[model samples]
Target: MTARSWPQTAPDSKDWVRDAIEASGDLVYDWDLTADRIEWVGLASGFFGTGDELVPDSGRMLASHIHPEDLPQRLKALTEHFNQHAPYDCEYRLRLQSGEECWVHDRGAVKLGEGGDPERLIGTLRMINARKQHEARLERLASFDDLTGHFNKLRLRDSIDLCLKESYEANVTSAFLVIGVDNLSKVNNAFGYQAGDQVLIAIGQHLDHILRSSDTVGRIGADRFGVLLPRCSDIQMNRAAERILQAVREMSIPVDPARVHVTVSIGGLVFPNPEHMTAEDIVTRAETALRQAKRDGRDRFTLYQASQQQNLLHRRSQTIVTEVERAIAENRLCFAFQPVVDAVTHQPVSYECLIRLKSASGELVPAAAFVPVVEQLGLVRQMDRHVLELAAAELAIHPTVELAVNLSGLTAADPTWFRALKLLLQDRPEMARRLIFEITETTALQDVEETARFIQQLKDLGCRLSLDDFGAGYTSFRHLQALNFDIVKIDGSFIRNLRDNPEHQLFVRNLLGMADAFGLKTVAECVETGEDAGFLANEGVHYLQGYYFGRPSLERPWLAGSQPVATLPALKSGAKKAGAA
Candidate 1:
């Protein structure tokens, strides 16, 4: 009985559907291919910001409202869908009746006639202004630096790459310059970081203002900016550098309480033929020149010109870099162990693991030969990792042998190196206890707090830490107190001829006194003669490491029959013998 009395169906369901679409701010249209007419439903006026009387009723009229720059893309999408039965999807901008522009997303499918030719296009159009704005912001962030609103390092490099390609094809020359703010740290310390940021922003704007329209400026470092000039000659580059220096010199940025007066140093390089050079190479050469400018004194310019000898040195450095990289890849990176002998016993206490690269010709390359190059090329991190791995392997094989490994200045602040160390010793914590990590005093003094934290991290991991090259840098008593080092290796310069050099003798004596006061063990390095070794042992040095003790050998000294002959022959009459206190 209830079914018989069912309510009548709605008069038309299409009206409700249209109303729903209108409420959602989407408009549907049926575009006739033959008549070139359009039948629109839903809120067309609201979507296009046009009054009801001005709503487009034809395909041509609708296209006229689209932004001229975006019309071609919409036309291309339409042609593809009409001819190939492809789905039509386009996002474009529309110039509304109010003279304001808005983004819109149009999606549709082509309907076919009896012969399968395009008959009509059934589509939906929705406003996408917000989404387009978000996409635009993301694009800007990816290509520009937030601090200075200029091209970021990545984008600047990409632009340089494009310019290089074009220049090579067209036979044009360009110049690149690196500009560094002199003593920005002093500004930060005196005027505060906000003032520093203001100074940086002002400097960036000044660079942009003073440079040519074709030139590009980018903030590459906290106190450094890079400029690229197209179609520039050596003379033009020099002029540009001088102009930049003058502009910065004239700038007196007001930092609230104080008007900060600052100067800049400029280094520039001209690329007459950049066929074999890369953006990285260009930047590095420019930075090298900048360093020279700073060294020459702040507020100056230095143009990098490679001399014949300099070119040869550069080629050699390149060859060494390539060799080191290949050696690492081919597993030819190894360690040579030199014993750090007991001061009294002259017996092996721990072997210092020195990094060595085996060349393709079977010649072992010393660290001094390639390390500086590696450090300069930003590849020392990789070398340091290889050294760590080799040291770890040795420790694993000889559980009883204590090994000391050196850390580069860069590695002292590298969190990644510490991570790798943790990964290697995570499962074998005992290995850390026997590990001695040697960080040079110069490296430790670079960022004393950071180095102190690194030292504490190693100590926490049960690794013994040593301050290598002690007395080589300006290490104050305060620094010695801050850094918790287990041993201090006196710089070899002071110990090389300790018995004869009275000044060095007094210096080593003071260093020894400082070590004694701190309750730290001491290792005297560069003890090449019996007198030096005897003097060091007499002065209460805890260890001796040098040619007189044992030269670094590729053979594992801890293994049976591989132990190095560490002899301290003919002690002085007043000096103690090996093993005698």
Candidate 2:
């Protein structure tokens, strides 16, 4: 037919097709291969909102209304159907003449001539913008966390698995960090779940800003999040975790006029050879380290130790408890004295009595290895009592020497522990003046009223109390004001690398100033170098204790006048570097 002409003799099927297109709200189009013209029929104005005007008849004029980005694809589809007799089935964006845009599902078929060359191409365009939007919503709901808009657990797992597979093939390391919100329950209980949700959202936004673009973060649990750092080493992972911790520490969730601050316990696992590890293995390792961080006291990061197997760890724990029990039963539980000296003068002012378990082989076991296990096994009460009795006996033998003994949180809370100490001092009441009981800052803060009462009872008996690990936990001036502590031991963490760490130096200075304001003596622990000692001495710290003064010894060096300092032993992994230059 010529342009603007319709054959009056057209078949009834044409009317049927037009009726069907209009019923389905579709736009019908036909292109004549020979004339290179396109005709639109059936509610064409409805598709483009261009009134009852004659539609564009030429291919060029029709393509002008199609979206610029979709024009090439639409043309290519038509060409394929016309020249190669291929079906046209594509969905693309359409732009109407009035600046409106919508999605369309375009499908076409070719009609061939007697020579088998394409003569015409016909297609139907159905607006599917609603369906496309629905699909997009479904995709987001499937792939993202509803609360944080981060990846859901399923999507995060897929990303981690992909990274692991690539790293396995390349023999590169990958790391997963699991972050857990501490005190979330308290927030939820005190404020509301809504406030708790706000906290999670804030944490997610903060993490998104802190992580690298390549890293993947997801909400893996209600109070936990997982991050995938592809090809990352342990040190790099730790640095990232440090940033996260610092950010979280600085964040505060505002509930009207009140603000709540929270901290995170981060556990990280590094798979140097990822080939042997699965996604589950990575998460499990990270979770285990996370629990350890929480157990060791929160606001810290712990790395998974692949060298320790589950069964091996269990056995080691069992053996430690058994060893502690045997030492207590056989009366082989002893104390090793490490001198705490005057910071200015190297002379010993007192001794920190470190509990040591004597094995059957006559070798000494350090307290760090067994103390936690002992506390967990409910044996700390007995262990603490035995250590106190031994220290009291030593104090009786050396009437002028002072000894500081460590106390676990459990022991401090146990009524039996206090009674045992009271019984030990029955005949030697004067020994209490030479004794100092050390409780960690975290332990004492667990129950303020109980800790206060305990401190009062000890003071009433003329025994001094020292707060250990002063800056490692939640250090507050309010707690210092409420509790009566004779001395504050600055934790070794801020002191280990003090010479090179300006931050640590500043922290130590502040701690010293705070203690001075409270009129409490400040003792810096883990002083590994003479430079560290001199630094603390200049900062007016009262006492220093570490290998620099003397290693822990079975014999009290102060009891023997002018006794030589004990030789230092090989440093354990993760132990403070003692006696370093």
**Pairs clashing within candidate 1:** 344-579
**lDDT tens readout by residue for model 1, 152-248:** 6556766788877777877888999999999998998898877988898999999888899999998766678889999888899999999988988
lDDT of 2 by residue, 412-486 (tens): 655567778888887776799889989888778865545776788889788999999889887678789878899
Best by TM-score: 1
Off by over 4 Å in 1: 1-244, 247-260, 270-284, 294-297, 413-415, 446-460, 478-486, 514-519, 563-581
Number of clashing pairs per prediction, in order? 1, 0
